[model samples]
Target: MQRVYISDTNIWIDFGQAGLLDALFELPFTFVSTDIVVDELNNPAPAGLLERGLVVETLAEEAVEQLFTLMAEHGNSSLADVSCYLIAKMQGLPLLTGDGRLRKQAAKDGVQVHGALWLLDQLVAHDIVTKAHAAAALQTMLDAGARLPPVDCAHRLAAWRT
Candidate 1:
């Protein structure tokens, strides 16, 4: 995993709701979010995430112009995703997103992307979360309404306990 990541709202919610956001802090990397994305986190949790070392940042001044340019080009682009993309692009960091559209758009724009399942895998791999715990967290995320890992990752999530 990269030493720094710009996280999308969905992935943040998954970890936050699953009680696994702290696991991210155990990793060498730092997680960052734009103020805009933090607002979209819906309250309280963003404060907690920040308290737990998640870096909430504002877009660079130049990024405002760049963001406007991108929005002008891709009228349908999500502002949330664009904020994340801009921060990651400007900082040369990878983005963490569970949104497929955001992932695809980031790829098209040459920005690197990852998702929740990868974070779970890392947790298990690094012993931050045991496989059984990681499996349970996955189930928790699903139950809490995180529609991630593309349904295709069900098998991996299922096999975590074995």
Candidate 2:
């Protein structure tokens, strides 16, 4: 079965808006989050729906050690980001994240990264929602304080329509 690793913040927010967490309940995949990600979510900031209960937050001790070593060897970013990337690397799973910087860094490290736009496309492709619905959901996310890039949002909508 496919395994999906999520970063600290981005996917949680997007999934919260798009009801993606509910959809995941039906998929044959395991969801994982790192300790660092757990810390990020436990911040004073409000937690999204995805972060509220959907993710499994447990990391092997060796995995945590490996993550720290990787962060030290490579350029370090946020502990959460590094942990997410390291977990994906160790497990050979694709990371689900919407942070551009993290996505680029994951790619440079040869890790697979899937962002919100990709999730939108998958929702469209799977007929989980209509193109119009997805577009409206994107707008809803924007109105809810999500800072999605205009071009990326437009492209995702256009792709859905196609």
lDDT of candidates 1 onward, in order: 0.80, 0.66
Task: List clashing residue pairs in candidate 1.
Answer: none
The estimated TM-scores of all candidates read 0.86, 0.72
Against the true structure, whose TM-score is highest?
Answer: 1
Summarize candidate 1's per-residue lDDT along 19-56 as a digit string, tens digits. 88788789878888888888887733778888888888
The lowest-lDDT stretch of 10 consecutive residues in candidate 1 is 72-81
Residue-by-residue lDDT tens digits, candidate 2, 16-123: 665556554444445676656756764223344345444655677877777666666555356677777777777777888766666777788788888766666676
Q: Any residue pairs clashing in model 2, and if so which?
A: none
For lDDT, the strongest prediction is 1
